[model samples]
Target: MSERKYQPTWDSIVTHPTPKWFRDAKFGIYTHWGPYSVPAWGENTTWYSYAMYREADENNNPAYHHHLREYGHPSEHGYTEFLPEFTGEKFDADEWAEIFAGSGAKFAGPCAIHHDGYALWDSKVNHRNSMNFGPGRNFVAEQEKAFRAKGLKFATTFHHAFNWFWFPVWNKEMDCGKPENQGPGKFYPKFHEEHAMPDKEYHEWWLGQTKEIIDQYAPDLIWFDFGVFSLMEKYRKEFMSYYYSKEAEWNKEVIVTFKEIAVGQMLGNKSTQFTFAPGTGIMDYEKGKLNNLTDNMWITDTTIDSRSGWGYVRESGYKSPERLIHNLVDRVSKNGSLLLNVGPRPDGSIPEEAQYCLNEMGKWLE
Candidate 1:
């Protein structure tokens, strides 16, 4: 077996006390909004983006044909091409925040960017952004304004690194894994070639984008989904410095929720170690939810329905309101937070099922 990767030992922020605001306020809101949502409802994710590069002609799921017919192939219409459809006109940030407050959310956050590489805020790094193209509005700033107005903490989740790699199939110009080698999508003229990976240019682009969002929104918390430790040390340091500097300016403390087994020394302990960081917490990915309470505080993020994908899907079935409330009570009793998700449609409207769930949750909170 190959050697294990190095895990950085970077320490958690100890300059200030773990903010009382976040500790008291449990639960938040997160949305997986992007070009994927533009299609409004599909099977969980933009799998076609990666399946186009797979070796086997057959995909793990046979949904590609449906996706192609639904949203033309990459050649004719690249994922980014759908940016025009992501209009948040229907998105009422203040109203959403108010609903969160009513639902007993301590803070509110948006998927600043998802696995689709589209930043919710205006980004100078990549042209594909909510401010400039998708929503054509400063969604992050709007979210911050609305949530802060309600005295709720502000947070942002970054899933850009995953997207940077996830979408390369589009750039690779590979066929739909067909040995016969079909033609490229309309926008992607090249077919059956190596896809371009993010190089130094992409790295610089990511940094610039990250910096822009941080400076513009000044989120009280920045949650990185996966690539935190894999990031270059210099970039990691810079990110930490920027985050700390920003928090200092606001006269507040900021928290970064990270997991162990990442490239760097995990600020938090592994599930085995139970060495969770202070103010920092744990998140039970899809299958795992904390059952037994730990002396440490943690958060469990689960979907309303295990069957439905995280992003909004039209035919999706959601969990009952009772189950959701049960989940919240269970987690809180264990000293954990519940971060619920509402997969908004491409037009920036919450789906009926998600809203229904939230409304039910609101009733329970009241």
Candidate 2:
């Protein structure tokens, strides 16, 4: 193999091309399965746990009332308690991989860690992970093996970067601020009122988690949620540099997907906000689509049932299979990949409605 010419710097990394395999594949599958799936109750979004904790009105707030009635208050029975119910007893990694392969997806994986701070794999940095608390299994490793066995490229999504701010760290009513709360601080670190931004220690922990995922799984693709732009600049660059360097070491063309956050959204600092220059990697649009054909390749990550929620809901409405198929065709025509998402139940079973849609897409492909 020829020597890698690109360094870890943004200018050098920009020279690296998007892998041909990704551009040609045009479709992939990823799941949003996590501890949040246990409650399986949220509005249309995946921020149910946060909402349940923040909302005080049990009368109007369904998630809040549900949590209070079912799992007790957020102060006493925090989100960490959901870990026990997250036992993936019925989870079949091979079966999920087979479904993805049968659906004509070229790549498939799980969101290794969500903003909920629950790591799917056996994480060394955080004890509040699937292996230790919930499933007692390395879910990511199982999925990776299954994906590769079916000739599919493995990928992993990381939303942990946003966990620092996603939860109500300052809310004294929640377990986050209570020093007596045992696991809440580990999962939901107490925020310093003086410093609105994450401290150096938190940034290092974030980077370490990313590195741990990369070193352990060697995912072909790493997808980031929107809040990553708010992360520290040095940490962002360090992660990208380390990831790209690892790709070179393994002699593989790895891809990193990031969403562009608009100005004045989260941090209001454009200079500090992370934005990928053209050709750095892939650009992802969450629950969004483009109007015109883009010269640069991109991706659209929409859920099978956009109305219910991305995780799981007691009663959810789903988009029709025909609509999803049409969206897939339109995206492919515009040089974009469709990374369709499906939320599995807490028991680790893919909803029948999601399965129906995937099967329909497979038939359309055939």
Runs off by more than 4 Å, candidate 2: 1-5, 56-62, 182-186, 267-273, 306-308
In candidate 1, which residue ranges exceed 4 Å CA deviation? 1-17, 46-48, 51-59, 169-198, 259-287, 305-308
What is the C-alpha local distance difference test score of candidate 1?
A: 0.62
TM-score of each: 0.79, 0.92
**Location of the lowest summed lDDT over 10 successive residues in candidate 1:** 1-10
**On residues 271-336, what C-alpha lDDT tens digit does candidate 1 reach at each position?**
333222333334434424676877766665666654546676667788888888888888788877
- Worst lDDT run of 10 residues, candidate 2, spans 263-272
RMSD (Cα, Å) for all candidates, in order, is 6.9, 2.8
The residue pairs that clash in candidate 2, if any, are none
